[model samples]
Target: MDLSDTQHRLLAYLREHIARHGYPPSQMEIARAFGFRQNRSARHHLEVLAQAGLIELATGRARGIRLTGPGTAGTPGDGLLQVPLLGRVAAGQPIGSDPEVRRELTLDPSLFRLRPDYLLEVEGDSMILDAILPGDLIGVHRTPQARHGQTVVARIEGELTVKRLDTGGAEGNGGHLRLLPRNPAYAPIEIDARIVDFAIEGLFAGLVRPG
Candidate 1:
């Protein structure tokens, strides 16, 4: 299905907006961007695009727009991956878990050394020395097991954290497993499997720093 000029511009705006902010623009924002008098106009155009298979829309969510076309941000056949942007994870300390899918991101597989199943927003500066800073989206390769000295997304008592894994036991330490922070100010998070419910969520593949 061929798109009208106005539809093409609107689709471009949606792509640029998602590329810049990691999410789609709201209906009001779209209406304003395209000089529409009402958000209904924006919705109408979006529905047209959806019918063309260029995008997908979810009901009742402010940022529910998703690009799924070939050679676009989402979908395959153009060397891209539609990686889901899961909720935030702590880089300093384990924070409350929120694994909800905020949105899907169109990313190049070459960006990460290892392809990631999903992306997690970093929330703290604990991993600064390793170049994983706050607000950076870290790629996570989903795995139940990670090797020693690998950076991992770990879960402790239901909370999530990003840190380097240390399985070698330290003398007199409570347990052989611990999560190490790159910054010197923070101490190692020693994991005692006997007491704390611990699990390796995934290995850190790479990262994307938002501009």
Candidate 2:
């Protein structure tokens, strides 16, 4: 879908801020920066994009928007809300893998406000810079968009991993995804549908630390 120039630019800026800051830019910031005659102008653009199936809103926060791009996925399980806790992810060079994971955990839906379709354990360091450790378990919200830069569990290039989203722009063509890490030692990884299917498993809403 083609975005209006305004939408395109606004989305790009938000994406950039998310990459650098870890959240969406506030409507007030958008208003002051864009100098719209009214804050509603900036808000209208977001509403347009959300209606276009490119984003979502969180209801009460200033920057409560989420982009429904490729950061969502799911699997069924048992619970009051039927939240699924995935065993682990096989995000390596291998393609089309049926991971040997055998157990799906059940979690309380109220904790997340989202009854996730599945849960996966974080397994690498590409995202260590983001304060996510190797054994920290991540909860995915089963959504397509990661709200620009919200941390997400994504399937990239035949592997499932977690990272922040940095996508968009005039160059926002097909299969162009940028996976950024919080730690400077690590570099960002980008892939597309052809090389790697961008499936957003869900937001890493929370984690468990066994003391």
Candidate 3:
């Protein structure tokens, strides 16, 4: 639906607030965010948003703003999906697992063409040639298996790594698993699943880059 610039910002902020904090912002919070002197100013904008059918507000609740239409909850809509942004996953070396929820990111479902289960923040340049760089948030779909040539989130000996999967060649390092890097500067990691704890955590879906 068509919306004024202020309405658009309000909706976007509402979505982000809900995604990050698990609830809508109060009128006071909106007023403070938009530099309005009174909470009523924020309420006025919300009323306009509701009239435009962009949100549904509960009459008596403090945090009642609910986004409606194409990019929010309710029904089988092609709206935004909340994906947990996880801690850094190494592209250079195996990193200790600390999969904390940094925040929730609201992204359009069609952006990935797959329902991503989470987001892993890149910490190194191992996959830079593939456009996956440090500080990039990669959307991943949780899976135990990945096909050859696909980028995957894999755990080797309890450490997480992101790399391109190569399953076509004969077993290297006495195993059938390998984590290949896209950059020419980095070497491939041959995994001996027999000796190490190995598993495919997820498949690469898409990326969210810094602005």
Winning candidate number (TM-score) = 3
Tens digit of per-residue lDDT, candidate 1, span 1-211: 8889999999999878766655578899999998999999999999999999988888877777777775466335544566898999999989988889987765656567788999999999999999999999999999887778999999999999999989885433245688999999999998886677888899999887776
Instruction: Please report, in order, the local distance difference test score of every candidate based on alpha carbons.
Output: 0.85, 0.59, 0.79
Over the stretch 91-111, how does candidate 3's per-residue lDDT look in tens digits?
A: 888798778887665555655
Per-residue lDDT for 94 in model 3? Answer: 78
- Model 1: CA > 4 A from native: 74-87, 99-121, 136-139, 169-175, 192-196, 205-211
The estimated TM-scores of all candidates read 0.71, 0.48, 0.72
Q: Give the TM-score of candidate 1.
A: 0.71
| Ranking of predictions according to TM-score | 3, 1, 2
Clashing pairs in 1: none
lDDT of 1: 0.85
Local error of candidate 2 at residue 150 (angstroms) = 2.1
lDDT of 3 at 183: 88
Better of 1 and 2 by lDDT: 1
The Cα error of candidate 1 at residue 203, in Å, is 2.3
